[model samples]
Target: MHDFIDHNLLARLSALPLESRQAMIGSVAGKHRSPHRGSSVEFAEYRKYVPGDDTRRLDWKAFARSDRFYIKEFEADTNLRAYFVVDSSGSMNFASGETDTKIQYARRIAASLSYLLVKQGDAAGLSVCNDKIHLEIPPSRSASQLQHIFNSLGELEPKGETGLVEALHTVAEKIKQRALVVILSDLFCDPEELGDALQHLRYRKHDIAIFHLLDRQEIDFAFDRPHRFVDLEDNSTLVAEPNLIVDEYHAALNEYLTKVEAKAHDAQADYQRIVTDQDYEAILSDFLTNRLR
Candidate 1:
């Protein structure tokens, strides 16, 4: 395993408050607000108290006027489960520079997210998948377990073909409880296959977020000289002058991205395209803000 540490990146992320840091994973039990209201100190609303209502929660003042039982409802504090589905396929290893590979950036994202969740006392687990799902860590609120996740992430390498649909189906089957599933991948696969996988996850009522990782050069067709572009997974190569095909490539990429976004929307999942050149914190913050809404 090749371990590359970016202390500067970690330091920058560690400085942010837990809530502000994990805003992308959506609100869990921590700083993020959830849709479900429960019995907490924070008053949510007043409801008619039935016979089985807890006597402590009864609002006597309200009951006195109405001559009926009423209870004050407060938000409930509950632990949340977060799962990261990281792709370890060959395509994820693509990098234009030595300092940052797609997989490397993904590890950082996973680590930061795990740190935020653990800090907030939420159960966080990791499932590393390639052509098949290899590792499965059941969600738990253990700092040591999170450390294990980071260690495992460091060991992962890009290999084999991309079988996104198959892996997602397996994940949907294993996770019995509804959880926030964050998929980090380049998404270099057939749209139909990817759609089917997402649908399966949605059918199971899992909150899904797709982090579409890509290189800026790939998106912009910014290759400077004639070169042979190779498909990492298939070992297929094509040599051409990029300028001749740049327009068509951008058009195709844009169309594909649009279709992916549409599919995610239809599945009721959050989808964000992340370019390698952008700042991770900003990307995460934007996603979190959307999640909070």
Candidate 2:
């Protein structure tokens, strides 16, 4: 019943399967190709195609060599644990355009991914944080568990300062096994602190992905007139003319973003910058497309 996730979006996204670059220890036998070889249609190796073999998978080149057909065999598929770590800091509530707030859009992403994973027989978990962890749900494959994830996401209201560093470290410790950790946030935390926390997850061997959400106004610096700029986290205000400080602000923000991107690369994390005006479906599709089987 939640608007964050709907049948239509789920139906469309179900085609896009999630994959991990390294092997995953799935809780149950699922569709993803496992690192270990087994019985699946993923084409791990080739075998001589026989008389009864389906022609669809036959290799004509192999047949031409010795007049014998070959069939490709695949490794076994397994499920993966997907952890959605969402930032509930006040900054994520900003929305300068008609599109939804960063937090709202993030919720849709977390919810949709959870639905997709669960529908594919994989497990999905939820973690909400702002200065501290507010809610935590361990990964689960049960379809009924999605209601819990949706309810948690729906209840999140972005407020207070961010403690993303503390959050990432805490969640990394909680997960007992390697998992796909996806972080959705505005990333307004200290850059060094952020890097350290993400590195902690990397040390644990968790596959990390960071979604850096920014509102259009933040990205463009398109403000025209003087106005009171209020800090959402602390409710602090400053009256300033946009034309005067836009250049300086852009320079500082870009420098900070560059550092974050470099840190992510150093840590081998998939870093994606998402603008609030962009469609979530397309963003997610691009991210998932790279790892699909």
Candidate 3:
């Protein structure tokens, strides 16, 4: 991770109005559609008149014009609900250089997104999880609530094995309404397990986006000197020469990432590979553009 300041990034992001940001995303995302329904001007389906139906829905203009009563119908407009799932596992605490830790990057991303959602009057919530959910905030459209979410994200300290699958399953069971589920994690776990968990969310009709966060050092195998690599989650250590294993390690890593991406696509979800070394704004802009498309 790089030494990018959170406040700086937040300030830059704040410049874009919430509606503009959402509209930018809306332009790219084929999944999101206008949710309005009415008979005023827009056309919707016509249903047989039932008792207790609103009389205003009746096409009185059509009836007087045609001598028959027909209900005008229009699509219903609805606000989007978004849930941000942050991985607080031990591996997310890793920072090999001047960059912030993965956890820090994840928090900034979560905060920016939550800010956007709440600003647009959409419901947004946060969930921090390791092996299980450590904190859960229900969806809300309050600025104060968003501040609390930012505070909670800022205070988090990562420490524990990843139970990504378990945590997601728990969340899937808890949320009753459909929502957009955004996952921010390093994703150092079994691919099959992760896929299964994501499938569960998709099955419930939730839109999903996976942000696979990682350090550039981890991806490029840039460690020059021989060193002991430690697995933060299991506390296991292994001595290795990067020059000797770099090629094999990268091959395996790429294969794993490919599998994850393929699975997400199959499940009708968006998958983005985010490097903590890059500018956060660029990554977010790309994501929104892709979403709107």
- The lDDT values for all models are 0.77, 0.86, 0.77
lDDT of 3 by residue, 1-293 (tens): 22323556656665453322121122112223344443334466766567887887887777788776677776433567788999999999998779878998898788888877776667779999887888999888778888778878878889889978898898888887667889999988888888888899888767888899999888888878899989898899999999898899999989998988887887777888888888888887667656552
**Candidate 1: deviation at residue 161, Å?**
1.0
Tell me the deviation in Å of residue 293 in model 3: 6.6
Q: Can you write out model 2's per-residue Cα lDDT over 40-73, one digit (the tens) per residue?
A: 7556788876788777778787778868778866
Compare the candidates by lDDT and give the number of the best one: 2
In lDDT terms, how accurate is model 1?
A: 0.77
Question: Over 4 Å off in model 3, which ranges?
Answer: 1-73
Given candidate 1, what's the lDDT at residue 250? 86
Task: Tell me how far the alpha carbon of residue 44 in candidate 1 is from the true structure, in angstroms, after superposition.
Answer: 4.8
User: How close to the true structure is residue 267 of candidate 2, measured as C-alpha lDDT?
Assistant: 82
Point to the candidate with the largest TM-score: 2
The clash number for model 2 is 5
TM-score of 3: 0.81
Clashes of each: 3, 5, 19
lDDT of 3 at 276: 88
Task: Give lDDT tens digits, candidate 1, residues 212-263.
Answer: 8998777777887899888888789999998798889889988999888888
